[model samples]
Target: MSEEHNSRTAAPASAPEKVSLWQKFRRWPLIARIATFGCGGFLALFILAVVGGACLAIMDPEGTEERAQQAEDDRAEQEEQEEADRQAEEEAEREADEQRQAEAEREAEEEREREEAEAEAERLEGMAEVPGVEGMPADEARDALEDLGFSVDFETDTEGGVWDASNWVAVSTDPDSGELIEDDSDVVVNVTRPEDEEAEEEDDEELAQEEAEEEQSDFTITQEGGDGWSETTVEFDIADNFTMNMIRNGARRDTLEAIEEALEEHPDSTRIVIEGSFPMTDQYGNTEDSVILRVFYDRETVDQINFDNVMVRDTIWEIRDGGMIHPELQE
Candidate 1:
């Protein structure tokens, strides 16, 4: 066993063979070998470039710093470009939003104007201008208003005694012509009779005046006293059965004549009190005499009043019971 061991030792013992990377690469498939070689080549080039760059930096410090500065500047420039792009996008979006808002407002204004125009058009549809009727005859004015689908109302002017529309002339209209009104509106025609025509009935008026004078002689002074004539009050009695012409004249005319006679009789009287009454039957046929007229007129108020023309009740100082028969008097 010693001789065998000496023989094994005499022959050089062979070390185990190590496999090289080149040989291992040679044993790989064609595609894997190409991929491995390409990867290894790139890695070797990268290592060489790194070692060479280190050597260059050590040899040329200024060039190394210039290259680093250039890289930093490129990075900063890229960031600035990105920021500019982002800001431009934001500004474009804001402008678009503003434009949309402006368009919406314009549309809303256009709609409102259209609605208003339509409303105005509707308002002016069936309206007509009121025609001039003043200074025209009452009947002619009424016909003209009726022709245009308008109802006519006649109002008598002060000093107007004639009730016939054909005999009167229109003084004015309520709407006063040339005003826009509905076609179906009411038009008031104020009319009056000419004074020259009233004078034409002088004979009849003179006869009536003679009769009034005859009637005034019957008005007896019932009572007369007040502060020793400084402010004298005169009360007169009027006939109850007195009538002024059957249908042509009013009963108030006799009462007015009685008042005038009292004033003439008591010129210095401050107040003239005249009262007259007629028998009134109620629904139950109970007949009783109630004071239907009372007149309290001061001398100053009577001076301003026109006794010949019908005195307006409101124009008088104080009047009660069956007020004035004038057209302008309210109830």
Candidate 2:
């Protein structure tokens, strides 16, 4: 009995200890336990998701959005540069083509002009080169040819117009001295008067005529033209040892008038040669007075020198049609 009483007294003390310690937990709620378990599960899931996301970010694809954007920008810049270069090249090519075209046009124009000039020259030369045309008087022919851009060399035995003997001339074209000229070249003419007869009777007759006619006189100058050649001749009287200045103005005037008439009749197409003779008087004593008989024509240069180096005659030169003429006195 005593033991049972002691046990009962100890039991009360233990009960208070148990109630205080378990009081809050027992208040409990089934709802609190369920909520705790749910919260714990949710925290575990959230931690797992965060770790997985970090791993996925580190192992991203080879072509990232940032890298793709950078590549696109680089490509665009390259394209822009290439386009600029291509445009510049095109512009340069176009300019070069234009320049070439202009040059070609200019060359063509020059060639055309050159050909025309050559043709004109050829026409005139052909007319001058005809043989057997020597019979034509040179003075009248020269005037006709000069209208066509020919340069003339003339010498007359008589004071151009009416005289005892007829005048004669030798004609040539440019490049008279050396190599032949092209077929188309202008005629150069040379004319000279016939020598006065050397016979004593002739001299006396001339003196008597001179005494009778106080003033110098001349016959008319005449001209004739054919296919390409023209003839001019004048009849005149002249004294021996007379200078050009000494020749009476009336005689010269008559010859000039006739020559002018011939030129008026003939235009640029034909070649003319003036033929005549003149007695040269060297009052200066620097030269000898002699008869200078020649054909006056356009060209005057000579390759070979003959007969007293007289510009009037005794030398031969080239003329129109690239022909050569060696002057010889009429038989």
Candidate 3:
């Protein structure tokens, strides 16, 4: 027995051999091997992905969360900016539409005003028929004629043989009553003052003698030089209606009398030229001091006229620019 045991112990011990995974796989069936390999490869890739994610999280936990938050904030900001731009665009469009509407309204209003003005002008033109002014006061007659768009020229006969339009009564009018005339035609008004019978009787002899003398001393006017005449210029400020009337009644009368007296001394004088200018109304019917007047004639004839002999009732005539006289030809 002892010899049998020694023989068993003396036998060589042999280690168990390990089987390789490739050899195991090589022993599998074709379909089973393919499935097993696929499953094993999938499992290995998933394990590697989990390990990589864990490593990244451990390296930068705060940075990863910050990057995600920043990306979300950027998207929100972009959306807000886009919304603001849309609102601004809408506001601009609304303003532009309003401006266009306002412009159209203004243009329409102007067109309406123009049409109304035209209609008013037509109505006034059609109603400009002249009316009779006989037996009316001189001022009333003038106003009446002017209301019809007619210019008025006044003449008065007084007991003193002097023309005083301010205190005269209109007797007759040129072109007569009920005469159809142009809107801007001139109308001559003849006016005379009433004379008292007792006064006339008291001064009959003296008036007869004065009349005889005046008839003998009256100067004759003739156009011997083919309507040639002497010219003079007078400038004065016309502030209002009162001043205009004063000029017409006082200054114009004195100037004409002076001219007549001067012509009496010169028998060769043919005529006397007179012209006047005043402020013109603008588009708004406002007057300004831009009027001008000029008279042109023979210089030699004007030199003989004596302006100093004239008698002005209200205002005095003074030469402007040291008595400089500018002459121009009549159109």
Candidate 4:
């Protein structure tokens, strides 16, 4: 009975009960126990995270690669959106600039049109219609133009200008008849002497008598007798080169009578002469005189000549020779 009890006690000693993990932890010191619980918790969390990751990978094999591609695609789309916005901004700025340029051009065109209109209006203000002066006397034409607030300029067609403008007629006008001209503009009246109507009235007998009289003497005098007869005396001693030239140029007894009358008006005046000048244009664009005719007059014995019903061919001397001679007529 003693041996049986000893054996039972030895069996109980040899197999002291194995401590559980919780019992072992509880047996440690306070700090050690806390450290062991924390370590165990961290290890369990790590194992659970690894197992969850493996399970997700097994469910969708290409999930990580697809996520990476989606991220890359999103980044590319954001960049494209920024580029589009920039392009749109640039286009808007360009359109605005073009619109501004077009507006400026339109404004400039309007201003030019306005200026042109103003100029046209101003031009029309100072304008007038030129009056018809053709076939009118020079004085009448001058009066007509002056009445319309225009100055008159005279141009003569005949080589020997008229001594009096009233004796001439206007053939035409510069700027023409029935045309528009500026206010106070110069109107040029082209004048010419009227045709000699009496020249056509000379019959053949009168012409033959005139030829016979010219052939008779350079100068002639007639005296009437009491018996209805006339005595004619021809004087060749009074004939001079100048008088012969005057006769050759169609001057008659009336021309000498007219010169004599002019001399009678100014008996004290010396060196009476008739002069005619024509305008000539030089190579240097200068207007100059070309003397056409010249005739010297004498006062003595001029009244002895009869000049009834005759035509004078030239004008008498009006001014002195120095006043009448042009620079081109000088020696």
Candidate 5:
């Protein structure tokens, strides 16, 4: 009976109760409780995140790679767009520069054309009117025309009764008078001798005939005894005045007269040789010496002597073309 009573009183001590997490958390102080709650919330969030990531990975395993590839494609597209934009900007700039340069060139050409037109108008305005110089001395008329800024070219009119060019008078003009002409234009002046001088020429011709009649006696026969042939050689210097007269009048009157006189003196001669030389200046600023020799045969008669042989026909043509003619030939 005493042992039963002690066992009942000592009642068997129960196994120590285990403290749950929530029970221990509830037993903490206020600050420790807050901290424990915070830590617990953070741990719970971390576990949830881990579970959500695993679920996503299981649902679509390639989702991460797709997102990365989309990001890379976005970056590449952005770079390509930027490069295209840069090129377009550069092209626009280049086009703008070219347009500006073309505009400048066009403006420059227009300005040049305007200047040329203005200069031409001014030149035309300054042109002078040609004055009449008929019936004036040839030299005086030429001087007057030249003073008015004209290039004077003189011509002799034998049919208009011109004999000596030294005292000749201008008969007409090519462009007439009161015509507006540029300074570079050529003015041709026709000249003729005074009426009084023409009357004296007839008397001179009669005297020349008488002198020829007297000179006929001076011809002497040569005894070379070669087929009974007689030859005469004559040389004459081509005077500048004579050359000029021939170029202007188209006839060497003085030379012909001298030859006529020689032929009248030696009518029996069969062959006649003539030699001449003249110096002239060409248009190219070169000095040329012209030499000529011509032989004439009495094919018909002395009165109708025919030209047989000629040397340097080109030189004669050049002289006829007024290349070797004096500027004052038709004075």
Candidate 6:
């Protein structure tokens, strides 16, 4: 009975207690409780918002598209500001990195400068004494270098020495020639010497005397005790430069090797030059082949060596000052 009375006492939809949200409010307030028609809960508002936006994009439905466009413009503006901020931070970071690199480079440069200065100071402070000859005679230089307590050898243009005439003997020295050497240590200095002109002059003279002596008819280069005669005849032309006395004396020799050794030993000797080869018949009909050579040397060099072929005036074989003798040619 009570339940039937309560159901009959309910208010109608038009009553103030059951008023629709639109009828209750002239405008919605943020703090006010909302009222709505009980159609499909509040889900119809969200669906309407989406459908209205889609319609507006196509046909400007209900001015919903205008509101969405405003929202998109605001979002784009915020993204642009964020991107700009990121770019500014990156630029600042790049500048800081450059500053750090520049500072490191500066420190390295200062360190190099300091090291160079130290090397310069060390070079200036050294001053020491060195002994022994300083120049280019290999044997002499070696001796000198050794005396200075240094164990060093040389490297030349060749294993021997340079051959150029105009070039001076230039050598590189270690520990510098005048530089201060370490206490009790060795000092090395490189020295070079010129070619010996005197030795060459002597060679020319000795060769000249030998040639001149060989050409004299009175001279013979035979030893005693040959079956009647066993001797060689070296006939050479006198170069236009020989004196009569030089020609006579050049026939004698300090040493006489076999025909084979003579030619092999002095392949370049003009005194041994041959015009032609032929056999000469002795009065007894014995045949002998004589060799010929040219004399082109000076007599001065021969005198220096106290050397000359033996000179023979008599037919008997004998050794004399730049002369020879042959018993077979006795008058």
Q: Which number leads on lDDT?
A: 1
In candidate 6, what are the lDDT values of residues 278-325, reduced to their tens digit?
244779999776432222221232123322222322211132122322
Candidate that beats the other on lDDT, 4 or 5, i.e. the better one? 5
Ranking by lDDT: 1, 5, 4, 3, 2, 6
Best by TM-score: 1
Better of 2 and 4 by TM-score: 4
How does each model score on TM-score? Answer: 0.38, 0.21, 0.30, 0.30, 0.30, 0.26
Compared with the true structure, all predictions reach lDDT values of 0.70, 0.50, 0.62, 0.63, 0.65, 0.47
Instruction: Give the C-alpha lDDT of model 1.
Output: 0.70
* Candidate 5 lDDT for residue 137: 93
Task: List clashing residue pairs in candidate 4.
Answer: none
- Give the alpha carbon lDDT tens digit for every residue of 1-331 in model 1: 9999999889987899999988987999999988988999999999999999999999999999999999999999999999999999999999999999999999999999999999988996877777888778888989998998888888874564556778888878888789888889998887777664466478779999999988656555554565654333333332344443331133355456655777776677666665555465779999886555555666666676677667552334244322323221113
Winner by TM-score between candidate 3 and candidate 1: 1
lDDT of 4: 0.63
Q: Tens digit of lDDT per residue, candidate 3, span 1-331?
A: 9999999999999999999989987999999989988999999999999998788788988887888899999999999999999999999999999999999999999999999999988766644556777768778888999888889888654445435555667778887878777788999888776553345566997899898988752323223344454333333332235554554454345334434554555545544433344566779999865534323334454555455664432222232112212222111
Steric overlap count per candidate:
0, 49, 0, 0, 0, 32
Question: Which residue ranges in model 2 land beyond 4 Å of their true spot?
Answer: 1-60, 65-68, 71-221, 225-265, 281-291, 296-331
What does candidate 5's lDDT look like per residue over 1-331, in tens digits? 8999998999977899899988887888999988877999999999999999889888987996788799999999999999999999999999999999999999999999999999988977858778888778988888889897889877764554434445878878878888887876899988766774576688899999999998753223221214757665444555554455454333243334434555665666555544444566779989776543343434243444333323322233233311233344334
Clashing pairs in 5: none
- Model with the higher TM-score, candidate 2 or 6: 6
Candidate 4 lDDT for residue 75? 97
Better of 1 and 4 by TM-score: 1
Residue 129 accuracy (lDDT) in model 6: 49
User: Which wins on lDDT, candidate 2 or candidate 5?
Assistant: 5
